[model samples]
Target chain A: MTLIQFLAIGLTILILLKTISDFKKNRINLLAFLFWTGLWSSVIIVAALPQITMPLAKISGLERGIDVVVYFAIVFIFFLLFKIIAKLEKIEYEITQIVRKNALQKQNNRPQKKI
Target chain B: MTKLIVIIPAYNEAKTIGNVIQGVKKYTDNIIVIDDGSKDNTYQTALQSGAKVYRHQINRGLGGALGTGIEAALLNDGDIIVTLDADGQHNPNEIPNLIKPIIKGKADIVIGSRFLKNQSMPFFRRLGNYFFNLMTFIFFGIYTTDSQSGMRAFNKKVAQNLKIYTNKMEVSSEIIKQVRANQFRLKETHIKAIYTPYSLAKGQGFFVGLKTLGKLLILKLTQ
Candidate 1:
């Protein structure tokens, strides 16, 4: 195989292994694992056949496979950014609620001095 | 969460919190004071006044304090929850008038609107109230005479379901949105407010209103 094929194949296999390990460790659920598996499989297919993306790139008005990959990466990063921000906000709300509940419980258990 | 529990969110209102709690006691014995990290003796004074005082480690603003107060009330089996300001701007005597609709099964939420008809309020402040009410109408599709009123009554279910995340003056608007989103009954009553020098001085200014509006708009977009 060519050097580029060897490198791409190595990286795809590494990522696929990591994804399976993450799923086994219960860090990622079945849906996320499937997503990563499908994504890396597509990457592996594209790497094995470098000429396969030409039609996709031309159909999407892009000049080259590299441009198509760059555009898709940018869109994927933005989607991940939105998801992370939303998850962060949810965590913040939960923290505030938990803190409030704990404070109230502590106050109720403690006896107060009556005037 | 069965009896009426009045939840008061106080922040740096040591001067008026004592009297406000005392006035509320005259109406009901189940009084809860959430001291939002006051720098003064607000917690001690509230404790001395015979109201259960929950102290936050740091100031969480009005919404944070109210969130704590409501959580406490719900946990203690509060059948009804009444919220009022600690600056003594709201009259504790009017708690009954506010809760009457809820007790009669006519409404699940009651708002003590100072603008059912303009009371003794400054022109700019009245304008501010109108603007907030209009915004609530546009955003939440729930119109009221005053959406910014601090004195409000909520049923136990409403208290438990209404999730408040804002930590400042924006909470007032957020409450209206929740009321609409949950399809709860909302009623407004004409309640008098004593806008004294102290209250006016400590109350939200025009810029604070703008900031609240911005926060609410962002909250809407995100949701």
Candidate 2:
């Protein structure tokens, strides 16, 4: 393979790996990883294989097929982040409810012994 | 597990503090009242009612008092803890029901809902609660009957894990948000609310609601 071809393949793999690692560490959903890898794989195929890139780019109204894949991946990642944030909020609501209840019960129970 | 305890956060609630303490003592003996620097004799009256009192040197707001109470409850070997407002809007008779889920190991947290079943609240307050309740459901997918309800119950795990920074009423929203982030089991129980004219007057008005939402937005942005 030429130097450019080799670089394209290596860069795609690197991006896919980095995205997966970030997702795992942050507890991002697995679907997000899949979407990213799909885009990365598209880049390798679009650059290394001219026949696929030329026809697809022309039909999709894009100068480069790889750009479309990257755009899709970015949008998908944002959707995933929103889902995780919503989940976190639900957990917080439950904890607060309990804490407030515990406080009230303590206040109520203080008077019986004194009486 | 150590015996369960209760924490009451009071701020200038001298009018109702004694009755609230008396009402709670009928159900349980483990109680702690944190006077949030009340300008009135809230602390003295609570003490007179026989509650273990922790006086905040200065007014810390509801959230600050709650944080102090939670810290004290943890240190005191409290296995379970319940929190209720000092304004006497929450019914102490519902304590057993709130604690049941924790005892059954089904939930780390339980919230008392005034909107559940037959309970009723004031018109404007109910409208405000419904609006926030819808927002919480839309934003977090947690279908609680009352998002603004001040009464709640927690196990030691939850009480120990809490870290609230909101000094005002938005701490209510913050608590639910934290529970969602931590991925703990949550449940809601039906409870009666006693919203007297005084409490209704003291409750959140339009400006207070705006302030709370703004504070929550700012906190969310900072985090």
Candidate 3:
């Protein structure tokens, strides 16, 4: 109908296709693939039929359907951000372990004076 | 006979590594220098100074260096392991007194505290240290005069038991936490800090202190 709605639907379809491709290539697990598929499918539904969000906005005590969608998006984004940060910290810890192991192994292999 | 191993974790301290190694050599020949990916000639200087050097391929922070140093010490069968700053702020002569508690079986770990006695520390630095001490107490339920002290000596058992997870300055606080969790005997002794212009510039400032605090908080939440 509207230009914005058409663009949102197109973008959602593209993202959904990418998520499926990632799942096919084994880049993401079943749980993650299902999550993205559900999320993008909902986005497509919300974009295609803007009136569907009216009940959600009313129940959430929001003035407009767009506000409800925006609030959920913000919450979802924050959750994803927290996950990313936690994963990054774990990766950093792993890297430190690797570096420490290598340094110690190199030293052990070298001949040195007795302590 | 107790074997005392001194571990100096150096990062870009080429100017002082030679002198520091020589100073520690006065007390013990088992000196370990963990060259934490220094861009300078720290590794060469330490080697020339006759200290065994273990170098990281890339820069891991203070904690990472200390972790490597401790492992190296334990591998060499160190009876008592002492860690001090490479900036020459910690006096090597005080090391004998620092490990006295461990040698006598009085304590498993001895912390060389700068705040145990009256010392000339910068006003803000003193205040910041006090703040960190209080935070360590609040988060881990263990209070000490200097939670961030770079000079500490621990027995072999303590070294093997302690796990350093952080790769930054927060490792100091994390060490205190591990000491408490492992129920290790801890003691604090007064030691003077030689704050030269070079060493003063290397100490943690306001922003780094804040980052250390943030990391400590995360450590508390996660662990």
Task: Choose the strongest candidate by lDDT.
Answer: 3
Off by over 4 Å in 1: A1-92, A113-115
For residues B92-152, write the lDDT of model 3, one tens digit per residue.
9999899999989999999999999999899999999999999999999899999999999
lDDT per residue for candidate 1 within B1-223, as digits (tens), equals 1499999998888899999999998888898899888999998888888888888877778888899888888877899999999889999889999999999999999999898875779989989888988998888788888899899998988998988988778899999999989999999998999888999988879898898887677567678
TM-score winner: 3
- TM for candidate 1 is 0.73
Candidate 1 per-residue lDDT, tens place, A25-96, comes to: 999999999999999998898888878889878888878876787689799999988777667656666766
State the lDDT at B170 in candidate 3.
95
Q: What is the C-alpha lDDT of each candidate?
A: 0.86, 0.79, 0.93
Query: What TM-score is obtained by chain A of candidate 3?
Result: 0.94
lDDT of 1 at B136: 81
- Report the number of backbone clashes for model 1: 1
Ranking by lDDT: 3, 1, 2
Better of 2 and 3 by lDDT: 3
DockQ winner between 1 and 2, please give it.
Answer: 1
Query: What does candidate 2's lDDT look like per residue over B1-223, in tens digits?
Result: 4487888999999999889989998877777888877899998899888888876666656776788788878767788899998899888989999999999999999999887786556677788988877766655556678888789999988887888866678777778877887877989999888879878877889899887776666557546
> Which is better, 1 or 2, measured by TM-score?
1
